[model samples]
Target: MTDVSVYTDPQAAVPTAPLIETRKLTRHFRVGRGLSPKMLHAVDDVDITIDRQEIVALAGESGSGKSTIARLLAGVYTPTSGEIYFQGRAVSSMRSRRDQLAYRGDVPMVFQDPFSSLNPAFRVSHGILRSLKLHQPELTRTQRNEEAERVIEAVGLAPASDLMYRYPYELSGGQRQRIGFAQALAHKPKLILADEPVSMLDVSIRIGLLNLMAELRRSAGVSFLYITHDIASARYVADRLLIMYAGHIVESGPTEAVLANPKHPYTDLLLGAVPDPRAPLSVAVEGDTGEPPKVIDPTPGCRFRWRCPLVVDECHHVTPTLRLLGDGHEAACHVAEPDAGMHATKP
Candidate 1:
């Protein structure tokens, strides 16, 4: 595999509004219909953004609302409240079929499992061709075929002519995953919501895929919302990192800065969990064994207080909001002080 390191064009101009932005986005699910129906807060009051040609990693453990956010951005699930703005336009305001189709084409999704994302019965080019047909209906049959081959080759699958005719089961896992990217690329999207695209592959294969993403970003000017539980991979490919805990964004900042000085206890716990094979192991941090709370009709308070070692009185009654902690860093915690690093204590 080529070097996994990504090159950033430092001189690239920033856009007026972000490529995509969410304002207090929230999605809830009603479970067990009865006299009293309960609301499961899948995502709650989350605000996030992805700039043009930028890669933002939403990193967290399973059930942290990472995938839910990706789905919301992809328009698979409607938000119970809040608004999604793409290029400063509210998504909900797009009433026409043309506008809806345009939005879907501009914001394609790549699911976690490449196998399920592709149809085993059809040839590998099926998805790419279909996406082209939807987004570029003006193109003729020959043009669609050419476009499909172009995207397949763009994802590093050389000799797209031969590869496009092959079945999904015939290709290796990495190749199949690349085809998934090809499908997204075929849409000519501005931002791709990649939901753990590399988690199913081997470590060596994962690097190649990561490099492909970097190459695509460099060559195509496409922004990505990369969702994953793997922080190390996120650090390798993402310019910015947002850490979510129990359906809320706990911390967010530049990837290196967030890892170097995690202000939130949950962020610290996630970092501590990643084992370093080179270093000798020591006792685990206190509060590492606790489980995340189930978000069924949750009470109003800081969600992490149950497992937080630095819990304070304010954390139990009042929910914490993300406060700026300098250097573009923000954390949603009552006890974490600005510039205090992760060693913050309760008064």
Candidate 2:
């Protein structure tokens, strides 16, 4: 596992306060607008922390409320309950437009679809210039252009001045995605909420972007909340891995430890689901094919109980909170031992 302890070091010069944190962070949507409206619990009571320059991957299935958490942190969606803290300051306290703009500058969001995120009508420079103008008003037009060129080049886009003049339609998917990163960089952000940033790119190109993220963290001291469903990619770039399911963070720990010895039944199932390329082409893969449940206005029991192969009697009645198993690894499961999934059997 390459001694993941270095990444988990408690003496890594972490700030007195986390760069970003969510305390019991939750968000619910009103699905039905009729006389009897029902709340769709998209995200429920998730607590996470991102230290300066740390890469934390939030991995799960597609509808696992991963993007909702990103949106909440990006200020695109208001949290239904709970609070978000940036640099130890409550996000709710930033009520004024100036405060909100400042916060957004410090924490920008790079979305999933590179094509849709940028304006087709405008050149690649539009988004970057807009961000710089809003975040760095002191910069003149010429300085903004220079800064934009520097950012474009920084993201590995060659001939930055030439590329900046081209429209979004002129660029490849990877190039457009680099532009997205450049846009975020224009704000000089401290952290970025990256929602499936590399999922849309070619398998070959994905590594480049992941490497870029690591480089950004190494050089610029930028932090990231990397949201994705690909466990392999998460394992590759993230120092910490957080497994989310049914609006709950089911498992979290240092990436290698959690993946090497997953404690929760759900986490075990998730790892089992990852396709093994080394296996024989003729060999059939086996595991439960059940899908994650859609959480609505619900009861108190564990949400994963229905899909869990190792569901216990306690899981049917009591919602399990994250308990420290050992070495900072935690899971929300009633029947799982600290070392339960080290040699987990396929269900």
lDDT of each: 0.87, 0.87
Could you give me the TM-score of model 1 versus the true structure? 0.93
Q: What is the lDDT of candidate 1?
A: 0.87
lDDT of 1 by residue, 1-347 (tens): 22122323332224477789999999999998879999999899999988888999999989989999999998899999999998888999989999889889888998899878889999999888888888889999999998888888888897889999999999998999999989988887789899999999999899998888888888887899999999999999999999998899999999998998999998998887788787676744344754577699999899988778788789888989999997989999988888877943323
In candidate 2 the C-alpha lDDT for residue 129 amounts to 96
Q: Looking at model 2, report the run of 10 residues with the lowest lDDT sum.
A: 1-10
Clashing pairs in 1: none
What is the alpha-carbon lDDT for the whole of candidate 2?
A: 0.87
